[model samples]
Target: MMVRFRPTILRQYLLQGQLPTTGCLRSQARLPCIAARNRGAYLLSYAPVRAIHSESTPTASNGPADPAFVPLRKLLKDEAKKQKLSGKKKKKNANNQVVEGWELTVGIEIHAQLNTAKKLFSGATTSFNDHPNTHVAYFDLAIPGSQPVFQKETLIPALRAALALNCDIQQVSTFDRKHYFHWDQPSGYQITQYYEPFARNGVITLQARDGIAVEDGEGISVGIKQIQMEQDTAKTLAQLDNVHWVDFNRVGVPLIEIITLPEIHHPATAAALVKKVQVLLRAVDACVSGMEAGGLRADVNVSVRRSDDPSAPLGQRTEIKNLSSFKAVEDAIIAERDRQIAVLESGGTIASETRGWSIGSTETRRLRGKEGEVDYRYMPDPDLAPIVIGEDLVQHLRETMGELPDAEVDGLIEDFKLTPKDARSLVGLNSGMGVEYFWNVVDALKHRLGSSSLADNLPCYQLAANWILHEFGKLWFDEHEDDAARDFGFTEDGQCARVPVDHLADILFFLYRSQITSRIAKEILWAVFRGRVPAEYASVRDVIDTEDLWFRELSDAEYAALADEAVKGQESVVRVFMEKQEKYPQGKLMFLVGRMMRLGPEERIDPRSAERVMRERIEERYIPRLRGE
Candidate 1:
């Protein structure tokens, strides 16, 4: 049925959060008529929404303007508030399951240093590791006579990042000075984009691999509120000697702050979203380094709400500032949620504030009360002109920005026929460099090791995925995580522990050709990882040849002789193994083969091949002769 809603009814329904979000609520009329897929078949809009729900206050004359929405408002108003406050919530660590109690809603605000050599509004260079105040200019120090000049080159990578996230670029966006008082920001105000953010309404969907711990983890698309350009403050060092020092080197450095909507329901989801953003930005060369380097950081807003009532208002939220790592992000949200739950259980109301996560305390430390928009006293900057992005520039950037992470993920699944989990795992490595390295190795194998035909490339893809993700990735992230990037690297400079891609390819090729046993390959792997092999032996083949780590299948007579030779020291063990082989086959047989394996000076036999040979000898020859069959 077509619903005819008067302008007053439409306005009241929207203000009371009873209507679905359609699009931007603008000053002008939306359209003469629009198709309503969920609400109704056809809906009419004759007037514009002057402001959003929170922007305009409800007056006395507006007492239940829509009779249909009044019952829902009254029904959920009290119970949802209580559910947010006084119930015990059940969670299994970031799962999206519907708990009987309160639930969490989190949003992320990420500020990343742009990958530019120079400052945003000056000619001074931007350096992270240089001496204090060496890269500063007069304007960076807030000189009286200095003026800001915008750099056009900073927009190249920034636009590439925005477009990579599928954001719609604004044709004209202006700048505003946000007033604040801080020791690091010597200028009384920092320039920002308040009223107009250039890139809006983008999305980053948490991939399948990210949600292996969560229920219904696929396609959780976190909406992007906006992406705005801004300047960074100088570094402030709070010394242990009770003195404060400021370095102006980072002053006026280019920064892009990406604001996300509160669509995240769990701490793990928020971490996944931030990681997705990092990989996306790094893939575009927008932000070169990661959160560990302080090149990108996230501020999360956390709130607890009742899961039973969908129409209930969100609970009081607190902002957790400067969460540097993804694990820190997850831990902060869990900490804040537990804190709010405790406050409500004690008959105390939660307050809005800004907090910081302390790694030592494993909790969120209270920073200050949250600031409102009016506290900033925002105003337009008179010196800078409005940024007008041309259509031609947007087109050029779109053409050269390369394939985005989302598309690349889909391609990996469809083209390579890999599992969705494997595809996302490949993309998440080293901020999207894992997929690049995978392709490089796959291409090398296709040409050098395997046949070039498409039918024969399955082995190449499977081999690359297994070794990179299982072997190299495990060592890269787990055991050698501290120095793996530099020591066992996937970086541009191949100055690692001699386990670069080419050397790894050589090792995999040797194993693929069946010239070396998996154990010997592992020996080579650990040798490369631990730098045990001398640098003089360049390739893995050289090390393998020098160490005599080759595989050879022995004949039946040789296997029988080896088994008889191994029986000398293990006669009692062989009798026990014959008695226990039928019941427990796991450890009994391998014990005999292990003795035979150590009989040689070098590793010349594959353990798997030797186990097969010994098992057959025990079953067909040794068992029958012992039993007189």
Candidate 2:
């Protein structure tokens, strides 16, 4: 049999110094206690009958008797003091010397907006820059009789992101209500996966860069606590005079929040980790990952502790919130870490609080006291049912998971024998489109060159990479200098709109064969990009012929005659070379070659060829006479 006891009756009995003789009297189960006046409800988990032997409790000798009550105020105060002292002790050594410096510990929470046509829970279009509240629906406004309908489009990208991060995707996950009171949150609760996240136990390994602890070719791994799907809040516009405005168009947009463990030791490591996530998300088409437009942002939690004390508990962390840029994230972590160390070293305690990153000043400003888990009052949402992933769904997502950034980078390094830096630059092209364009050009060149292997054609690969990254990249950027949203070689619809990949390959092919100099190649590229070249001239050779830009190597007889004329024209230089042959042999010969190239040709001549012919003529004809041989 089961019995229930009202909390009021239990509280009265405890206050009256009476022990109930009934079921669960000796049980260790927690019982709720409701108190009168200023005291609120509390749970009494340890109710020992031995402490209350008699119905009437004995009065204290030095104070009024209240034997049933134990005030938690003094106990909490003592615990706080003990914890503070323990933290301080860890900063000192056996000689009681304070440690020279503190270690910085950082963790980041990234919120990436999922790419979809509609809002996550409503049918409103997800287009940006619409009139304020124009795209909002009844569900987005959280009206009296409205409910959210989940969007299936959000799951694919979310799953792809989980796989990219090496996360363990859960077969089953549930949503919860994260309660908070804010004007921006019209619903007063955000629908998020709090109890069981979609994925967990993931890792993101970052290659060492500037300000990070690890060296080049070395990496540091950070643990991913979880990745959860959550709804975005409305954008608050506080710059208006006398009234604040809210934009609900962004409300109900889907986001996947990736929470990392506190393993970062430097600001740069955190930034690098964020950048890696951005690249992965973009590669998988999970998000646009635009920080400036608020598609991606980070909340960085920073703390400082003694580097010597690995076992010591971490210092009270201050979270720098809503850092929209990588530079802001890194700078904010650095500033917060320094502030925390300065506080501890000056005999002050670090407060557990939430801070705002001041982008302009590069500092962290106090926002609010940190909130505990209980403060949110999380509960499973009754409206939405739990989602279950079957084997078929997981298999489909895995099968379609395209090449991620790291894998692509490694492939470029191995197959093309490109350096890690160059390979990384290629994979990082236009958030991976550059890689697509690069390989497309390579394949086209292979067909043209009658080669079946990229590895077999190292020169072609090198030339393609160099021209695409340096020359083509410059032209692409220059064409879209005013449009920040323009992607390389792609239109807004994601079509290949810039110079065709095949055309670029033809240009590189001509360059590889030395039929045209780099200057002519660049000019041909620009002409094609600007549509100045006619369609009939499809290949680089045709373009060179049509535009009359082909360069010719000088014939030996022509070069001999030109060199003789150049020596006669620059007699002073020839005399100097003859007088000081030991000091200026090669230099004097090259001077004659340069003068001959300038004076001999209406058509451009190859400089190297001219130099060779000039050297042969001078050594056989001029040098013999100069040395009296």
Candidate 3:
């Protein structure tokens, strides 16, 4: 069915004019009448504004006003009405489900916890993993008689994060109060941006397997609606059997809320968008960006409607929250879409509400209905002054933003001449490289081997990459063995062993460049790691370390006795060399040289050099026919 929105509402839908989101702005903007007719509908008329003699102080909990709206609200309400009407007359689909190939419109709101040394308003530390409540200050805890003092350090990271996402920075922006009630929130309402966000009109470029893709621009532009700095609520932990504990340590931590337009369609795209944002956040060093740690959280809004009907508006959307994992987020969206479709097919009305995903059941369970917007009762924070972004601040932040993950990955591929797949694997290696140290280790190995040209040799690079990730990684991170017992104990995973880069380079050079067998080099490496002398030594730590070399510990008297005995016993094998110089060559006499080298377990002889010396001596003394000729 065709539906038309009133001029004011349509203006907001097209984003033609900015709407007042604050309670103060909402009261001044007059409401308009919404008219709907079947099959084809147009705006019949809008209610004229009734001018009041004098204005009254706006209260926080002002009930719904008559025909009330600014632009965005009017558009949202008109669209909601159209969706509600379409649901009543919509035909039932098969399997009591929304038909396959149903068009789904997706949008994302990403909240990143800003990385900082201190809380937004308090001097308490913002670092993670501290003892619970250790980082809380009076303001952070929302203690009685406490006032907030805004921190510039908090805002700097948000700006950097927005820039990393390829967002346009707004020169002018303001904050508002977002209201709700919870024990975790000691503050009645959160100070956020309802007027002007710090970042807007940003586009993110992400590379999927197929080609380069932008989150916005395809259909919805997934355009960045806004990014604002706010404070985080306290963490709540619920244990077994209905016991709950609140950790106020995280309260008032600085955070960034990034809202996207309705553009994303596929589940993979949603996951990709999340991952891309994660990279940018980590690159900026703002917010830990670790999913397990809840440094970042995403709320997904999904709506499924018929592609066949252009006139019919979008279906009612369910807001799915608490989706911490990428897989969970996608699954929740799909499940919610299916649930909405099922409700429509069963001839039931779908209510607009917030829902939580139950991963165990693979369903979106409703948490709340179209609830009234509680008055956060926003007013200018008297305790804190407004932040002004100066040219130097912007310039400094721009420099700190650094290259984002996608750009860095591209550099790795271009600079190292890595294949696309290899580059991707490396970028995603070890849950994605979060710091420079990981990349440095790989580069150090590459440089040491002088294998710069061998990067295109993927098999060789893979071999090297794996060893660093596994062997070196194991030394620090692997808990199976404690290195305190071992000679070298590098406390952290990144610092595996202090084995110099040049030393490793020499070992690899011997194996690959000098053509030493890998087996022999490995033996040498083992001795080096154990702090043993070169294998030419006979004894180590008062033990015969190996049978190969045996003369180091023994005195001069023992070497003399063994050499005399070897000279007497090997004359028989030496006699044959004189009789048949034509039949027995160096190859045949090498066996006898091997025998003499093993004669003294106390002798430390270079095996190859000794064999050459023995052959030359035998040829000179015993080969009579060849010598005379």
The residue pairs in collision within model 1 are none
Q: What is the lDDT of residue 225 in candidate 2?
A: 98
**Stretches > 4 Å off in candidate 2:** 1-100, 209-217, 238-243, 479-495, 534-541, 555-629
Query: Model 1 off-target regions past 4 Å?
Result: 1-99, 410-425, 454-457, 465-503, 519-550, 561-596, 599-602, 621-629
TM-score for candidate 3? 0.61
What are the lDDT scores of the predictions, listed in order?
0.73, 0.74, 0.60
In terms of lDDT, which candidate is stronger, 2 or 3? Answer: 2
User: Per-residue lDDT of 544-580 in model 3, one digit per residue for the tens?
Assistant: 2353322233344444444445546566666677766
TM-score of 1: 0.75
Instruction: Please write out the lDDT profile of model 2 over residues 167-228, one tens digit for every residue.
Output: 99999999999999766676889999998998999998877432244421378788999999
Scored by lDDT, model 3 comes in at 0.60
Local error of candidate 1 at residue 164 (angstroms): 1.8
Clashes of 1: 0
Range of the 10 consecutive residues with the lowest summed lDDT in candidate 1? 31-40
Show where candidate 3 strays beyond 4 Å.
Answer: 1-99, 210-221, 370-382, 417-421, 428-462, 469-629
Better of 1 and 2 by TM-score: 1
Best by TM-score: 1
